[model samples]
Target: MAQWLDAKVTKRIDWNDHLFSLRFQCADFPDYTPGQFTKVGIEQDNGVVSRPYSLVSHPQDKELEIMAVPVEDGVLSPKLHELQENDDLKVMAPATGFLVLNEVPDSDNIWLIGTGTGIGPFLSILADSEIWLRYKNVILVYAARHQNDLAYGDFIQQCQSQYASQFSYVPIVSRDKADGMLHGRIPALLQSGQIIQQAAQPLDAEQSQVMLCGNPQMIEDAMDVLKSMGLKKHLRRSPGQISQERYW
Candidate 1:
């Protein structure tokens, strides 16, 4: 069982409509993989209830941060939505999960696919300096309901500027379309050959590796599409070229 620690909300950042970023202070928090999540227990009316949220900040940071979308019917999400500076919440520690770089084989091209707020961990992994040396081309494909729904726009642009030749950022907004951004769901893009066309190279299963994180349905859809393209599911015992983390 994980031990619960009481941490204060150091800051909160609103990331457009529906999503928010929360930074919490925890002393001596253990290092965690980017795609890992933590059970954040909320202070409720009668008792405390917790919900799992993916870690948004990179593990190297001292203060921990998480990006979340509020759910109305959720037991803990609403309270979390109302949180303010100095407010305290309990988090189950230390964080844990497998959708990280260590489980993946070192490769030349790495594809990080996500929908909605699921892109948090991938943001961390891609920003980390250690992973940059091993991977030649890093491609990020993010899909959201609207263009305004996209998060971390500035940070992504920074990556593009720094690693101009090595990094590629593709943002797909289904309901809201703009000139430069893809206008559809990620799976649809993959199936319609848009992603491949933009990639400018045949997405060969043998040479490419994929990391998926998002709503369960989206995760399932991505896995199926990739598998149909000959990509295999990765496992701890016998790893392959694809890995998934269902943010649900």
Candidate 2:
């Protein structure tokens, strides 16, 4: 069980009209691994309404961050979007999730694939220096409806600077196109061999470790294509080439 801890919104990162990130300060919050998520909530007339959000800030950051996109018919996200700096809220303490790198089997290449706000955990993972130490190549694949939906370009650039020879970023826009950016859905790109081509790295079950985070359908479809390439769902009991987390 997790205890509710008091936190206050300290800042906001607005990427576009629909997507944003909230950074909140939780002085007493325990340190959590990259790729973990915490439940954030607010008081409602009936009770406390909460939703799980993947941590976007690295473990070293003073404030915890979570990316969000408002769901027109949902309960928590819309209200969360309306919150301003200093607004008090509740965060379930001792953040928990299983997508962290410790759970991953080391390999020559580590592929981090995410879509929409699902990119949050990957952001956290990329911030940690451990990633650079564990893999020879780290490829990030972010797919969104438009170029605007892609967040944190500056941070990605920083990683590229530090690991110019070891890092690759593949940005895919489905509903829009931009020069020098790959445009398509992830599963299709993988199936057609465009993703690896753009990254200049092959997706081989024997040599690649793929971590997927996104909508269930995308994960589901992408896994099928990966399986065709000899990749299998990873499990501690029987480890394989692929691991996935469903953010939506």
Worst 10 residues of 2 by lDDT: 39-48
Tens-place lDDT per residue, model 2, 90-133, is 99989998999999999999999999988899999999989999
Q: Would you give me the overall lDDT of model 1?
A: 0.83
lDDT of 1 by residue, 53-129 (tens): 88888888888888888887877776788899999988889998777788888777888889988998888887688
Give the lDDT of residue 170 in candidate 1: 81
Each prediction's number of clashing residue pairs: 0, 0
What TM-score does candidate 1 reach?
0.94
The C-alpha TM-scores of every prediction are 0.94, 0.98
Off by over 4 Å in 2: none
Q: Residue 79, candidate 1: how far off, in angstroms? A: 1.0
